[model samples]
Target: METGTTTSARYRRFADLEARGYSPLYDDWCTGISDDTELLAMLDTLPPARRQPVLFLGAVRFVGVPLEGFATFRSFVLARWPEIRQVMRTRTTQTNEAGRCAVLLPSLAAISAAEGRPLALIEVGASAGACLYPDRYAYRYSPGPALDPAGGSSVPALDCSTAGPVPFPQRLPDVVWRAGIDLNPLDARDGDDARWLEALVWPEHTFRLERLRAALGVVRSEPPLLVRGDLTEEIVPLVDRAPRDAVVVVFHSAVLAYVDAEGRNRFRETMLRFAAARDRPVHWLSHEGHGTLAGVDGAMERAPEELDGRFVLQHNGRTVARTGPHGQSIEWLP
Candidate 1:
């Protein structure tokens, strides 16, 4: 595995990607970056956590998707090295995708019904806050009714198919107030920030771009309150601002993996403390990779293969279902 004295997570990530059927991008990078010492060195400049292949390529394509350069991955990347480095120094592969709303509404609806009131949303690693507007988006489910509002499709089209005992999410919860915290907060109103958010998407994904822009459009007139800081430290203060009448639900999707195990534990403990210190009902919904969440009672029994490389969606710290990495599809469990 070692042709040189240097080892990079970039290489390992590419290998993993190839196995997972994430084509062209993985093979292209693995072939190109492996041979180019300068490109590998530029990657070394990136923080260890941000050196994954997807982040690097996403940054490159953020400006434009590489099309003509497929013949030589090294040359294509080398040409953009300087610009990519400048962007990487500031950005953390941050994205504000709203597709997860399709999967999330089912849980949110149940929580809202139980609480008998509208829900307040507090999101961690929220990026540009598009996901903060899940209620504004429209959904089409396989075994479910059309989840559009009274009018036509309000936002972008979000479609998801569900299996098992997971019921169709017919009625959505009213999100009275919603806010988010991120390491580097992005504003959909800001040109550069919005462009960078779009850059985070792979070049082939026009549908995702449409969803992102649509979500941004929904919140443009009145964007959610996005605080810039660490999630573990910033969550409670934001929680304190929610309406007293609303049941606050703190949630995140595909976010905890970047957090170290200690940080993740701290986030959970802090939420537990916040919930216990009040009489109001508090909930945490997490949609993350299999091993990301620290302690869920029955979670350890499921192996990697059984989990199928999909993100696990949890409610109140319990495993409920496995979902596609980006929430494009879902499989419910009993």
Candidate 2:
């Protein structure tokens, strides 16, 4: 069978198990089986002596219907065994590449442009506001471009590639505010929230979790202004209150997938209304599924089909950079 088909079958099985109240076990297995290859390989290598213990643990973790509840656990496992087998048959790849890239580079460019200026950055699905700390870190560009903050005061070195070795000047924006909004704002300092954030990280991508931890350290002391509310309900009012002198950039990473079509439409409408009225520059940064955002009758409309696995760096609907899969590496485009 094709890999995609196998993946779908596994997903369905897990979904069914989850629906049938095997969440704990499902979660445990999900967490344990990070790499599909390794997980699939384990199925055949299970020693006879370890079989009962592994099965018992899986049952306890998933159903809370312990080994003592042998009949019930056996029935549940037997019923779902086919799907579980299928799950062990597939491989896992990084799925958040587009989203990660979409949010990172554009925001970095925006922040770089703002320099000394205070800009208000509002992120939808802020989810702990870890990405907001881009200014606090360093970046190494492959093509001899490097940025290291001097004095470690959040002022990054702007190293650009050019003919003459002239120092890249930092241009600071006159900013009056910086904040973020999310339906569920994660407090990195909060233990439970921190754990949830950790759980969301893909097991294969351990670096992401490390980066998240480092970002959290900087943000906890100087927390980004976060509002706990739905973007649809909160964004309009928040935009209305934004200071005119400061540049307003509304961004989201990996969030569009969770919102429905109607929600996206309303969000676009509200942003456009603000843009039209304010005359101040409003930037929308999105790392959503493939599709170009088109200007139609004074509003923006996203194409039904996405740009197909390309990471886009856009500003005011202009494409700045496009890369394959992940955004870790970037090439500048005119």
Candidate 3:
């Protein structure tokens, strides 16, 4: 009957995470704090802005967990709850990690080569739009070629090793134009916005934190054209404005989960209609959870060992790769 009660909505979230094996660490915390008033109140620190699980953890990381143990973690969270809450209110956990570019690079390059020119990328839910500049970053794919930009950014290279007959990218595709649509876009140049982006990275995954900073360095010079609006509403018009000479590739990574079933269907229909109305081909690229994005052939999903994590990379509705949630690496489908 209270926010602190196990049956209350807030405590239920902790219970859900515990039930699902999110982490032994989280499972332990959820179990420990299920009835603790101080801890429950700490969880409620952030205003009603829909904070993600990572926000609480990141706060400890952001403040430097001082010492390990559950006691230390709880103290840090309670001590800095206000600061964490402020950030949670101001920054959405829109972790736009670019590590995925490594998995996406081969397909994009292939598509660009087949077209004999560059491709204009249109990313929906392009929070901070870091993934939009995959073409501009350098890459190292194990058991394959090393892909690099003409004048590569000093930003840490995207290292993705693939299995099977996946063809290594000959080169990064030429990106003639690019744009991203977001409800609230974060500018890489803005210190606070950029800091929040870095904060969103999971605490233990230090490499991811490094990658975010590296990515920010690469795109800061030439800021991405990120428009503020819903994906379904802003995508088509932005696509219309892109260079007719270049192919239009509509893409998203780990974003469709935010959209309801109807919204996802509407987004799919919108792209189909936009392509139908245009003479040039409009390729749609999706890298999301297995069932999060529709049109994956059941073959990939049916395979047992191949699926490592939730996310799958698809090219125009066909499954290409089953990947880790953050694209730490991937298992390419031949």
Candidate 4:
């Protein structure tokens, strides 16, 4: 929760940009400023005329920080700046980039096997629920080995490489149910919400904004169940209601970094408890950085490596695989 002063300061900056009529090219301007060092460095690379708008957007976003941390700032931005909607929309598209999707196959396989039926996914930080539609789309690479029951394992290892584009299976999970949960759920059908999502995107990545618009067209027609609330509080109750025969899969990408340590623990415990109680299958998928917080200028700053690359797939309290950053490849052990 950021202070009102910080929120106001950020809004003012956004306002100044709007007044100047220098809208950003990309929607995920915040991410460009925050995550991608290359993009940040390139901000100065633009000519002075081009650089002003970019700088204004970044400065405004940076000022919006409630407590000088990425998570706090992101939350503040999402809650206060509805006009910045497109930024998030583009971010959703970039997040689902081809490379990242390739990395998710192993987890997909794990969920498929655990259900002993097919998979129905629940994404916590679904953004716009783009990745949830993996089954409906086509991928260019090949999937790894199928689950082997003879291995005396509840989950089988997927054999895949992490170097390049991996092939995804044409077969989608049965997908009896597909739902999403987010603190701020974006409804593509709602023009205002759609605009807010777009504002969340960085101005530098124009392609992502385009993808988001295209994705939104599809989502508007077939929207997933998206609930707005705290994930730690809402997950257990939701899982309890899931169909008994279907596997309960909970996944999040790049969202855990925003939650505090206590919140993270509570979310993990809640999911674990729910899975244990069901005596059925459960899968937890996450792509987030792990690390410790350090004190900087009397404020807590997370270590850079804290959020380094790692894709985790866990089932029934067991970790199936711990792979590199991109979800394209994995090293799974039964």
Candidate 5:
């Protein structure tokens, strides 16, 4: 478990780097909590994993706390620590941000084009499987062309800013099959599950909330198959179920941090085996916090200072780009 000092440092980091631009309300709250010794003591009592700002803030939001001001929020939290603690214990941060698909599109397109076959997508931590339908969402990458599916425009058009020689996808990948593995798979059609997802969205991001609603609508039309299990145990079975004619692409975003170091090592070994087996074309696409994946950091060739506060995008273990946590930007590297 993390000590009070470590928890406070995490909150400060979240305030300055993660929430500053995206959610001013959250930034202020985190900043305030970082300095409040009483709040830190309360937060430090939770499991180390639960001490993260996202889970804490999300728990409070889930409990219907008004997020208008830091003082009011803190007061409510202090008075109802037991209620919020229960929420923190029972709920995990399953941020199913469909906007991430915009960043994954290029990699998926490249793999499909190279293999000359449609993709069979297997998302490791697919909360409600909204991201499983990247083809169903339109794209508007700034300083570049807009892309829509063959059937025409779709709801929640994704907009991402690009830098470097980013290979803007000429067309969406033809996804033949999709499945997901999650410890607790959520149903987008369920009201409470859907509301929980909305609560996870940081306050002040109206655009993200709108995109999430649109994505939920898309998924409800046809939900992908989501298996309830651990990623390491469930992945192979799920991948084996894919069509042989299609290229299998195993991917995840902001998900591995929940897995312990040993679990991550096992997952890395599993993917390496799949890549080496080459029974068919299998690719692993990972978008995660810097250094979260083994060897991805060494592959970057960039200094640590250059990569601070960004998610590293890797395609089959090769560093490709640095991306915004919510898919707001992509700075291509490879």
Candidate 6:
């Protein structure tokens, strides 16, 4: 467990940097919690990894806590500490957001076009494989035309605002095969698992919740192959399963921050080894928080103001764009 002072700083940073513009309720809650010594001490009892604001809040919500003012929220949490703690320990913030596909389309399409072959996607830290079906979902990027699956419109039409020279794809990439690696892959067809996913959505973001449900429906109808194991250990085997005719594309979004530094290095090395051994073309796509991808950040010369709260999109270790956390917007890099 982290010290109370360190935990308090985390809450402050989350409130000021991440929650301020996105969710006012969370911003207020976190800001208040930062100064609440009692609450800080309570939070310090949990495992360090499980003490994240998102996990904590989601656990409480999952256990029937109402969205109320700081005092009420604190009271409910304190009263139901045992229940919330159990939930937190057992669950993770597996935000299987499909909207992220919008930001990823440009890169995926570019790979397919460059290699002149269909893609075989392998997502590390894939929660429910919701993100694996980028080709199945539709996209509507502002200052751009509508993009849909070859057949017709699809559920969860991901809408994203854009800026800069965003490389809008002419069409969705043809993904012939898809698989995912997760420590614990959620079954989209399971009611309990699906409900837990819905509960993970923030309180004020009804739109995100609706989108999640739509994505869940699509995934349930034809779920992708989700292998359960450590990311570094399972990734090579999963990639080897991809058809030789397709180009292997390894990608992830908002997942690596959970991994420690040593683990991240191991994952990087594994990817490099696999890419070198493959006779066919292989592309690596990463959409994670700034500084989350080691070398990718070194190429980014943007001011702190420009990079704040935006995810860094990289392809083959090269910076591509600064994207919104939930795929709301994209600021394409020059």
- Taking the tens digit of each residue's C-alpha lDDT, what string does model 6 give over 92-161? 8998899999999999998899889999999999999999989888888997778989886557688999
lDDT of 5: 0.87
Clashes, model 4: 34
C-alpha positional error of residue 280 in candidate 5 after TM-score superposition, expressed in Å: 1.6
Provide the clash count, candidate 1: 1
Using lDDT, give the best candidate's number.
5
Task: Estimate, for each residue in 85-194, the C-alpha lDDT of model 4 and write its tens digit.
Answer: 33322322213322244456545754676456776678787776765654443333333434222222211122246433333343445566778888777677877566
lDDT of 4 at 236: 69
Note the Cα lDDT for every prediction shown.
Answer: 0.75, 0.50, 0.72, 0.52, 0.87, 0.86
Q: Sorted by TM-score, highest first, which candidate order results?
A: 5, 6, 1, 3, 2, 4
4 or 6, which is superior by lDDT? Answer: 6
lDDT of 5 by residue, 219-306 (tens): 8998899999999999988888999999999999999888877788788778867877856657999899876654433434557685
Candidates sorted by lDDT, best first? 5, 6, 1, 3, 4, 2
Alpha-carbon shift of residue 239 in model 5 (angstroms): 1.1
What TM-score fits each model? 0.89, 0.60, 0.84, 0.57, 0.92, 0.91
User: Candidate 5 — which residues are off by over 4 angstroms?
Assistant: 1-6, 294-302
The predicted structure with the larger lDDT, 1 or 3, is 1
* Candidate 4 RMSD computed on C-alpha atoms after optimal superposition onto the true structure: 12.1
Candidate 2: C-alpha RMSD to true structure equals 11.1
The per-prediction CA RMSD against the true structure, in angstroms, equals 2.8, 11.1, 3.8, 12.1, 2.2, 2.3
Superposed Cα deviation of residue 21, candidate 6 (Å) = 3.1
Higher-scoring candidate on TM-score, 1 or 2: 1
Model 1 C-alpha lDDT versus the unseen true structure: 0.75
